[model samples]
Target: MPTLTKPKEHNRERPVVFMENVSKIYPNGKTAVQNVSLEIEEGEFISFVGPSGCGKSTIFNMISGIIEHSVGKLEILGTTPTLARQQSTDVSFVFQEPTLLPWRSVLDNVMLPLEFRNVTKQEKLEKAHHVLKMVGLSEYTKALPRELSGGMKMRVSIARALVSKPKLLLMDEPFGALDEITRQNLQSELLRIWETEKMTVLFITHNVFEAVYLSTKIAVMTPSPGKVESVVEVPLPFPRNEDFRTSHQFSDIAAKVSQDLKF
Candidate 1:
């Protein structure tokens, strides 16, 4: 069994995530990813973009330890991917939809992670309420999933992921299903969360605008044995707001990423 090996003291030299020439191939020899390498610094927000079937999600699965790589090495928080994932040491995944339990109340749902790890009831309630407040859902603690809007449910999912205090967050198109207005709102919320929590985020999105709006770095990929084609750094300053969206720099970077994705 794989065991977690977090450093006794936090090391400034260690990256939050590192994929060194990683690749994944299926049993039938279908190459899902090839020679992909990435290094994510602590507290950085990154977006991975490509057309459908570009192996974007496959990379995320490997980082999350849901799938093992066929070649090369990968590490999350200096611990092996399998150990990091098995222990839930420093990573969380937010899937496309808000997969909240329909039967559970909002507070209970947020506390589910604690339950999974055998946390005390008092600590679970406290942690759940704190994160719900951070996500602006404190008052709805007792409300059932059916009572919340789509956006609110997604917030619940986010709160659940955050309650674990993960250092690395792997998001697979968490906002793909929302309407334009809600999507933008959640995007802003995501940024706010990142700023306050200082977590390293690896987000996967097909929307070029959304990718540019949220990322500190954009990793572009190609399909059919997916490989990273380019990695562009966002030149904009931190604490970016609505005005930055209208700036020329944002447009230029977004355009460049768009042009790269076409291949």
Candidate 2:
């Protein structure tokens, strides 16, 4: 059995997520990632972009402790990834799809994470309601997932992730399935939530424009048996909008990321 060996107290000197020449190799002798190093600060919104099978999802799984690396150091929130993923610690994940329970009402699905928590029923309800409102889903709390549109369903998923008030949020292409209009709308909504919550976000996206728009920093990776090609900085100020997206700086940054992305 592999047990977690983490620092007794949170190590404030380190970044929120620190990866030192990490690599992931599967039992089948597949090297999904190699020599990937990154340091995410306390409140940054980072987007990772690469082609399919480029190990973007692999990196995410490692950070969330769903899988372990074959070599090198990776820490989340000042501790080992596995330990940081425990309850009472601040980490949450939103998948590429809205994996909600179709049978449950929106509010019930959002409140499920709190079921095992030590909080009282009232506390859970308050937290659920607060997050639902934050995602603009308060009015549809009683509706089932089947009754919601794609965008609304995703909103509920985000609200559910936020219910726990995670300090680090990992989203794997959460808006990838939506139409362009809805995707852009949710992008703005996400920025609003991030600005207020101040959570460190790690996002995965295939779209370069979306990556540049949402990220304070963007990491580009190479194809299969992935390795980070480069880290591109988005120096633009936050509260990004249509104007920022249209600006030359935005295009310049997006082009830089695009150039770094290898086929």
Candidate 3:
């Protein structure tokens, strides 16, 4: 059996996200989450792993300011979630689906966020081109959504998310629909991008191996009325590659995360 490792300590001078006794209850009296508190430091890559309907996405929604928490305090970058979203380019979200406009070209889709900002057309194009290149999609700038593979479309979605230069990136199972190989490839690519961009990431996924492979820390939540059951640390160093995936440390960490999810 592999030994379980505790999450590493951080400086904790200031957290990018802070949630204290947070809960989300629907009007119908369904409580999706209860008494959940978590702190994420800047530039950390954190993954949330749990079974379906465990309120993982609910947490994401709360952080993104799409839905307010019913009780307790939630802060993003030291401000209210709503205020953080409206006042700063601090948060971005990538959903399960790419959700790209089929008629729009790759560059256009990536440029969509900048359209709402004060940037000029030339600036938007320049930023879009830069981000697309970062995601290895510069050659597909003119292709429409229909012309690209599922993985390519997701790359475009990620580019769009990065175009705004967010301090926090939230991804909710963005690669859930892709094939295993493609998903693994994107996982590696995302790690590279995360390192290069130096942005904080909160990723949600059902795949235990994926959560273990990509995150510095894994937040394991119990089923419904979800609370964080445990936070597991992956002690493996960064710049992980294919060999890392097959190593004993990787399997051990993945097994520990999987064991935690069983509760």
Q: Per-model C-alpha lDDT, please?
A: 0.88, 0.89, 0.92
Candidate 2: residue 253 lDDT (0-100): 92
Instruction: Output the lDDT of residue 13, model 2.
Output: 61
Candidate 2, 1-263: lDDT as tens digits? 11111344765466888888899999999999998888788888989999999999999999999999889999998888898887454999999999999999999999999997888999999999999999998899899999999999999999999999999999999999999999999999999999999999999999999999998888888997888887788888978889988999998998888888755
Per-prediction TM-score, please? 0.93, 0.94, 0.95
106 in model 1: Cα distance from truth in Å? 0.6
Best by TM-score: 3
Give model 3's clash tally. 0
Could you tell me the lDDT of residue 102 within candidate 1?
Answer: 93
Which wins on lDDT, candidate 2 or candidate 3?
3
**Runs in model 1 lying further than 4 Å from the true structure:** 1-12
Stronger candidate by lDDT (1 vs 2): 2
Error of 1 at 151 (Å): 0.9
Error of 3 at 210 (Å): 0.5
TM-score of 2: 0.94
* Model 3 CA lDDT for position 190: 98
Clashing pairs in 3: none
How far does residue 211 in candidate 1 sit from its true spot (Å)? 0.9
Which residue segments of model 3 deviate by more than 4 Å?
Answer: 1-12
